[model samples]
Target: MKINKKIACFILSTALIFTPFLVNIHSYAETTSIDNEEDKREQEERERQEEQRRQKERDYYVAVEMYSDFPKLKNDTQNTLTVQIKNTGGSHLEKSKIKVSALPGEISLTGGSSTTQNIGTIYVGNQTSVNYEVQVSKDAKTGTYPITFEFTGNYGTSVENYKAYSYSKTFYLNITKTEKEKDKSQYKPFLIQNIKHPAIINKGDVADLTFSIKNPNDKPMSSIKVSVSPDEGIVNQTQGVFVENNFPANGEKTFNVKLFAQDKAEKKNYSIKLTVEPTNPTEQTDSKSSEDSNETPKILPTSTQYTGIFYNAPDKDEVDGVKNPQIIISSYSYGGTYVEPNQQFPLTMSFVNTSSQKVLRNIKISLSAEEGTFIAVNSSNSFYIDSMSPNSSVTKTINFVTKPDATTKTVAMTIDYTYEDTKGTALTAKDSISIPVMQKTLLSIDDVAQPQDVMEGEPVNISLNFYNLGKTKISNLKMVASGDFTVQGENSYFVGNLEPGKNDSFSISAMPNDPNKISGVIDFTYEKLDGSIETAQKKFNFTLNPISPMPDNNNMDDIQPPKHDNKIIYIGVGIAVVIIIGIILKKRHNKRKKSQELDLDE
Candidate 1:
């Protein structure tokens, strides 16, 4: 019984002692696990914040929001469009404004006479709205028309990021119709009915010129500015000024312009001037301009009006109260946009009689090209056309062979035409066509001339040989070296121009900065035939070994050189001399001693 009690007591004591240790181990493990999870969460949060900070580096950017009442429209229908411009950038927009425009006659505003509207100021992360009442033209075709909105403003000194903005978010409207309608899209609704001015102004005297303009359309016109110009020997007092007025529908408005005769003004009917702009515009459309570019070239014609003219400036001669028909080259096209060198291609063109009332008869057209660039193939440069009715269009195709050594350029071809009206009055006009020619680029370059093995901190001369393989010259040729090294001289070599079959060598001295990194790239950049820049790069790789250093004998030496002692050599020589002297002395002393012994014996 006693042994059993003792064994049970020992087991109980062992359990009690290990229980606290096990609990402590579990608690410690749980704490470490919590700390790990927390650390992971904190790292993730830091990464997210850093990403947000980098994204917020933008100084300014403004976006636009728009809505329209009608997505589609019929002829002569009116609608409303609301534009909301938002400043989503990190800065503010000062003196902001918007301009709305469309094809001059395709769409117009009903209640406005100016396309520009100011939106004073827009704070950061804010928005502003503007409204417009738009009307579709009666002569619109079955197509989708775009309404351009241009937003312009400044971002204070942050103009680098947001100088001026042209939000090209075009609002489109679809026009669906089956039958054709009358072409009244670009009709002139305003007329310069009368002009009142002094017939002549004396020297150094200013005169007033007035123009009476009448608006026949149903809409009112505003934003009209008129100016007058002067002729030879005459000074224009209104040179930099304009007379502005508004003319209601079926109403008349007069503009008065001032002109001053110069001191040497001519007396024989010096013609005065009067000029008008936006002739029949219901609203004055701002000039088309893009933010990135000064102005986008217009690809299509729009409604144009001459509200004013240079009064008595110059006039075309008329025969029997009939103006001669005007003929022009409407458009032209070729096999494609580009013509290969030394190849024959057909150029198709359309000749249009611009006069709606007069007919052109017995039209003779002649063509001429640049010297040695193009030649008419199997046909003369002149062609004849028979009688043509009023507002008629004719097409002619001419085959042309380019010169074998012709360069890449836009060659201009002159077209001179002579035609007669119904009254047999001869009229002549001249036009020019731009023909774009392209010559394929062919270039050869020498192999990479950089050293295969490079040494750190040492400058190596890298050379590249390039030759123009094409027959045409290449302009704006440049050579640039890029790598992880320091350049000793000019790293970029401007070749400027390379003639056909011309060869040139470019060299640069580069010093490798790191032992592990030694590589370079030579890039050849030049403008192609189409005026687009192109680059051809040749990459070279080399291994950099550290520069050779003087021998370091401090750490350890294998063979020790024999040590020399000048004192020992000197002492040995002295000892040898002394031995020779002593030998002689001893010999002499022995002879003397023998003599002394003999003398003693005697």
Candidate 2:
């Protein structure tokens, strides 16, 4: 039986330890199966959406075809071109067109030949055609040239659709070279295209001028140069008037010219002319021996001019109209130049708005004292003024108090204010005013009195007179005493506000339990006229007497009566009841026994 019990206990312990691990494995397996199934379903849905998108594009796209009638032609010979528009897709093309044009310099189109032709609505599986006459340039090289036909219009399956579509097709034609020589200026390799200038130039101000040049031909031009000159009273800065030495072609080039207007020049429109030319001409010789190759290449000089306006400085009247409002401190007044510690008083100050054009609105004045040394009484730190007209002034008053421990010195009252202009733009301004504060805390305790004889653990009352001998009022005055003496009840007392040369009295209860001599500091803390708080202390010393024991009294009156107890009374009552019952039973038994004896005797 013992062996069977041991085996059962071991099995139970093993099962309890591994049960949580087995449950965790089963839960992980279930979660993995759910995540894998969800991923497979999402991927299948994405593939279905992608296939649908590709099918929609195939149903909406439009296609067309175009070509030239002659595959080959001589230079300057006229040729005809044809275009075929087809609606090969499922939807109908509501409107479309084919516009033909030859590339400049390479080929040209006849004047009377139609270049752009419109093809009306063409339904699915329908087509349209257009014809154009074009000519290859006489100077065209022996190569193929492209003529572009642009197709642009709206198309849809229904008449209500407004979708726009644009496409183009270029047809190439083989051109045979012509024997005619091209004019040098007709297809100039270099040209001065344009000039850019600033819109306005104030007197005594500098202007930036830009000249743009480009090569109109496919071949490059070497030794390009640019020159410029300004009209009267306008001169260029201390830089070269002519820019030179560049091999420019096909691409555009820009050069900047810095010009300054004379201070005394008339405030009117002025102009500057710019010229561009190549410093060298085309040459086939390996070495130059002619004037066209050796001389500076002014290939085909081109000139143009640009104009701008100038203005003088504005006057004071105009300046005022653009300026903002200005705020400043005008004046201030206080009850006294100096203050007693922790005395509260009113301070009045004035402010002025110096703007000449606009009215100030939503004006607010905020006040702050030196940190830790002063505070605003009643939290009167901010005041509001609805509005102040231009060159107007306003005054405000606020209560301030100084801290009790603040030193006698001058301090600043910071005034920060914000206002809005007539246009509703907000602006902030700041100013400060200095004020002298007298911290002569002439407060002291006098007329100290206490019992000459005292004992340990005995209660004592000490009395003293307090006075404020400063030059200002001390607000919220309080007195406290502490040290070797144990204070009973309240250790501090309020003496209210004490004006200059004033006195007050109060009493404090204390007990001397340890020190042989009574000694402690009497602290006087109060608020000043500027709302600051501080403390001043006075030390005090007094002798303590030894403890004396009184004689004992032993009288009978002291041992009079025992106190009543409810539990004792209840116990006495129960005992008396038991005795009474016993007596009654005894009486009954005796009477019965006597009767029996009598019967026996009979």
lDDT of each: 0.64, 0.64
- Global Cα RMSD, each model: 33.7, 44.8
Question: 202-283 in candidate 2: lDDT tens per residue?
Answer: 5566778777777665545445556776777788884535545434446677778787777656544465666655544343
Supply every candidate's count of residue pairs whose N, Cα or C atoms clash at under 3 angstroms: 5, 24
- Candidate 1, run of 10 with poorest lDDT: 306-315
Best-fitting candidate, scored by TM-score: 1
Q: Model 1 compared with the native: what TM-score? A: 0.33
* Candidate 2: segments with Cα more than 4 A from true spot: 1-322, 443-602
Listed in order, each prediction's TM-score against the native is 0.33, 0.24
What would you estimate as the lDDT of candidate 2?
0.64
TM-score of 2: 0.24
